[model samples]
Target: MTEQVMAAIDGSQFSEGVCDYAAWASRALDAPLTFLHVVDNHPQTAEADLSGNIGLGSREHLLEELAHLDEQRAKVAQEQGRLMLKAASERAVEAGVVEPRTRQRNGTLVETLSELEDETRLVVLGKRGETAHQDSGHLGSNLERVVRSLHRPILMVPATFKRPEKVMIAFDGSKTTRRGVEMLAKSPLFDGIPVHVMIVGAETGDNRSQLDWALTTLHEAGHVAEGEIRAGEVEETLRAYKEQHGIDLVVMGAYGHSRIRHLLVGSTTTAVLRKADMPVLLLR
Candidate 1:
């Protein structure tokens, strides 16, 4: 089956770059590009006021007002959604992808995408939403939440990133790492790009076999790849490897352990996303 690339847009300026990147990837992979904008039902603080009244009649009036306000917001959202999708489709055309499809959804962002994950070959989200404060590379909660919830590859495009060159794979021989390896091996996104598969953690006698497996998979895919098994903390090791190699993008698996474990000990994926200066492609 042909791959399907889904880009989650919010009519934000940052989403334009995400659409462009997804479009380029779609063309490169001969995949279909889908531009998606979720009309969030969650209201912003500016649209609602709670300080005016607290009586039952006042509450009923507030509900009525909120309902009206939601209708207006939905209208504006629909207009913007059309424009965003149109612009994204034009961009895909410029990138040589014809007949890109655009979709508008109304519901929880992560929940909706998760429902569509089966047909989606990859999910692309802007690192930060349109309302995010400038100068902050920190991703918004929704993006982060979606990453944690879904079991699909997520390609997060930074607000200002133009394109990527070298790709880095954070390999550790875990199930998640293997999934990422499988994705990179089959996906055209990393085609023709040098894949630096770095295996962090203390190298045991068994690690060599894992390295061999990763290398074999890439080689079978006709990709140029090299493996490195280093001893150190996962975050520090990957960060150092990125610096030394001038890596343009980092690919890894998202959350691995249970939420409780992750909350207490923090997963390597979280650490990498939070600290890595370059773009990250996370496989679930």
Candidate 2:
């Protein structure tokens, strides 16, 4: 009954890296790792001309053939799931996870997550999956809803995994940012990592004051933290800072001052998530 770090994979290009990051978290946090592959029961329809010109017997035969094909496709999908799970599990084990477990469930990804949320310690998912976005620069369709559904901190894995050495949290002096600092402080996942509390906005006195407050809280929690205030647009400034400083991980609250802005895919969070070339730890 140990809490598990749940790694959701879709047998897509990002699945392997997802497992590797999950393995790293499991080892670092001393939690069991579970790789979950959800067999989404998407609807499949048999073609129908509906012209009513065919004989009954021929129509029946065609319907039967269609059903058989559907069954075959389901079997093939299951086989692929098994193979993906096997490969992901092997990768996790090789990455130093003590005993990684694999699960193949049948449902939509969101439904499966709702059922498994109670047992999850941390959730790791790819920023973009195979069909995550049909177009370039779009987040996975399920990403927003998944973040909304879970109360846990989600670590969105990017295209690849490099052992993150430096971690930075986007600070805006909001209540959510304060909560993020507390969450990071309470967890050992970022132990001994130098944390850069960065604020990107109009460099007002209040902004500097908030940054100092964040710095103090992190210090009280025994973290090596520094506060820096920059002036510019939030997304552009933070992205520039991350790249300029060679930041390995980016942490930020999923929502900032306005809930309306983040209600859809039109938020600074999404912009950073889409642009950053590294893992993003999104706190709700």
Q: In model 1, which range of ten residues has the least summed lDDT?
A: 257-266
* Lowest lDDT block of 10, candidate 2: 43-52
Per-residue lDDT, model 1, residue 53, is 61
TM-score, every prediction: 0.87, 0.91
After superposing candidate 2 on the true structure, give the runs of residues whose Cα lies further than 4 Å from its correct spot: 43-57, 134-136, 259-261
lDDT of each residue in 1-284, candidate 1, tens digit only: 46589988885656866887788778777779899888876734345467366777678877787789878988898898889888888878887898999989888778888888878888888777766655554656777788778877788776555567788888767788887888888877778888888888666877888888999999999989898999987888888888899888998877553345563124777777766565788876
Candidate 1 Cα outliers beyond 4 Å, as residue runs? 1-3, 44-48, 51-66, 132-137, 256-260, 263-266
Q: Roughly what TM-score does model 2 have, to 2 decimal places?
A: 0.91
lDDT agreement of model 2 with the native: 0.81
- What is candidate 1's CA lDDT for residue 95? 77
Taking the tens digit of each residue's C-alpha lDDT, what string does model 2 give over 154-219?
899875789888899998767777898887776788888878999877778888788888888888
